[model samples]
Target: MWHLSRHCSGKHHFHAIALVTIHEPWGADRVGTSMSSHIEFRKLAAELDGPAFLPGEPGYDAECATYNLLTPLRPAIAVGAATVGDVRAAVRFAGDHKLAVAVRGGGHMQPYTAEGAVLITLDRLADVTVDGGRRTARVTGGARWEEVIDAASKEGLAPMSGSSTTVGAIGYVLGGGQSPIFGRPYGYASDHVTSFDIVTADGVLRTVSAGAEPELFAALRGGKGNFGVVTAMEIELFPVTSVLAGGIYFPGSATGEVLRAWRDWAATLPEQATTSVAVQRLPPVEELPEPLRGAHVVHLRYAYLGPAETGLELLAPMRAAAPALIDTIAEAPYKTAAVLHNDPVGAMPYQDRSLGLAGLPDKALDKLAELLGPGTPIPLTSVELRALGGALDRPPATPDSVPSRGLPFQFFGFAVGGDDLDELGRRLDRLFTAMRPWADPKHRRMLNFLSPEEALDPQSLREVYGAENYDRLLAVKRRFDPNTMFRMNHTLR
Candidate 1:
């Protein structure tokens, strides 16, 4: 019954969900605005152990904003929950009050979903634990990478986390995490998790691991966040912290030559080196160091975990590919390896899309260079290819884990923002059209990078999971979430 509206040109009618107006946990929550919606939310708030935010609250604006900066989002009640009981209460509150429910993990959600629902803010649920003897991290779903990595590194352990330590653990894992140098060691990040504390459609707190709920584990992994709300997860970690991390950026003029050269070198690289070639625009900020500042360049980010000499030797061919405009690659701590990507520290409006290809043929490389290099209207900011099939190819010790296909999950995409979002999306689509022939028909879109509206398509989900696994996920959903009470994403089916 709670209504959510923002002051951005007033609220438009949402044709999102065909919800039912009943106060039951088995059906969809009502979507139409009601006169006593606030009062109903107040009543539900009284029955919960969590703090709820109504419209006009002091912290309302900050709480509802996601990683996206383009769209203004506002939710009715932002529930700050601390315990499993609190999450259960919030779920019941949404069900009884007939309000849509949206879950927030690190507030990095790209597609805004705070329009008409009761937002479940997971920031307060932060928790990170490390078991040094076993080299594992038992982190809460709401926990950020800083907490997970900082704590794990203290015990000489590290997990397959993302470049930006600010990203959420659960969100990154479920969407398939691409580590700093994943291809050489761990193929993908999702294969590291051992267990998940899941809240399914029926609002039940279920513990899913390798032996139990195997199908669910597989589905939840890389299937995207469709089946349930993950509360906590136990993921494997590695020993040591120091790594040879950094990048070498080539000038815009050598974009084609550098990309082709780096591609060939990476193909012959050993498992100890993790590297990707990125096409980036140097920002007009003094924060950027010399050489790389204020210039568009093709950059090669690298992480060699084995040893420094071996690392230098492995990249010799790339060093000879093209004279570097700015080379920062060197031996550095793995904890700071994130600096290689240098993702923005603050939140900005961003739109992401990804394509997984088998190999970058000569023609595909030409088209990529055409769209990414320079003078392209879309400004395809970054083109990253993280090699797959390292230790990540090995089967995990848990059930319902996201499977790591023993093949290169080549990722090529860009982050677009500013006032020309519509133009950027259209331009990227056209560019992708030119490159689609190079894409493997069996390739699946990475949920973390796909457009959210198109992300939930069943066909896309099936593509990501393959038909057999997708059918298996449907059967698992039937058993744990038959009513589809947890209808928050595109991966759910």
Candidate 2:
């Protein structure tokens, strides 16, 4: 147990009373007021059960490596927050010192770091509690989707999580999570959130939900981490133990034919099913299956929670369009659904762009073939198109900041991370231009999919949240964080 109190360390105006361990680099004899600040910092560190690493200290470098290899964090201090108390103390210290604070969970953000900010790595705080009887799961700030999946699977339940299990559950939901398999049926992961336990800028913890603090609840769901640092969230779950899910790989030779067939078939899909098509250029890595190794294949990924026979029958047209080089579609536990999308497990340089489409008309498919098909100038890893409709188009019972509900589909293209960031960004722009004809004029972009570059574009943010929701988000920001303390994530400021 920890409590915040004051102390006097030399000329320092304020300090905390707790166990202290000061690192060598931050010596007391340092010149200027920095010495006094360091003394107060040591006091704050004392309040934490875990050690806070100053620059050049052991474990400092390891704690700074967020998931995205491209983003590097250089903080004067990096704290490994082991508990809710630790997080609160770190925030309070940063507030007291006037230092910018950035929170890290799974650390999957495209450009995950904020230079010169005090980084709070939440890796050590993961603790998932599955209440199977109530069909809910309480996920801590640091818990990843994989942990939630593993725990919930024990009771034949599943959270409305995204394709990659490594993604942080709280961050994903805050950014409006889009599950490749469950999105069309479940709307979005944010809609299932029952409540959020957050520490605001003033170092006060508040439980935000529909009945209590209803306005904050609506904003928190898809507002990113602008108002506060979310420490835990209670999310509703579904009774889904297994699914008829997997990917069908076809040769590049049938790209157009197969995509066209899949598009037509997508029009007939039911709410129980969700599907996406991708043109993937798999590397000759030993980690991949033999059939997919060193192959450029057109993949049709499907997941259906209904009977296997009906699911297979619905997929027959795409299967018959061309001979599948590899078909992994079969009844399997929902826990293994990540194999369908198979997002890269290893850290590497990568860039991506996303846009919503009103419909995948012939013009759109032709553009995809031109830019992402074989022999295109861009060396893309995959150009994916996900079918969106059904529940996704309907308003959730609880209102949220998500504005992509009525879109018919969404497209994403990612390429190998390149040394020349500018050149890579320009090439990605070309892909967006090619699809602009069919792209939704509103140009809604999900926060989870926005790259660091896109996140800075005010026009992009305006289009993403729509005028009214964006205004509402700003209002909440003004109330809870007038100074914008939690501005690291995709921010309203």
The model with the greatest lDDT is 2
Model 1 is weakest, by summed lDDT over 10 consecutive residues, at: 1-10
Tell me the number of clashing residue pairs for each predicted model: 10, 1
Q: Compared with the true structure, what per-residue lDDT tens digits does model 1 show for residues 256-346?
A: 8987887787778777777777777756566666676667888788888887888888888888888888677887666677557776656
Instruction: Report the Cα RMSD per candidate.
Output: 5.4, 9.2
Q: Please give, for residues 308-423, the per-residue lDDT of candidate 2 as tens digits.
A: 99999988888898999888898888878745677766665656788888888787777777766677776677788888888888888988888787888788887665456667
Give the poorly placed runs of model 2, Cα more than 4 Å off.
Answer: 1-37, 107-111
Residue 176 Cα positional deviation in candidate 1, in Å, after optimal superposition: 2.5
Give the TM-score (vs. native) of candidate 2: 0.90
- Candidate 2 at residue 418, lDDT? 41
- Clashing residue pairs, backbone N/CA/C < 3 A, model 2: 349-417
Q: How accurate is candidate 1 locally (lDDT)?
A: 0.68
Residue 327 of model 2, lDDT score: 87
TM-score of each: 0.88, 0.90
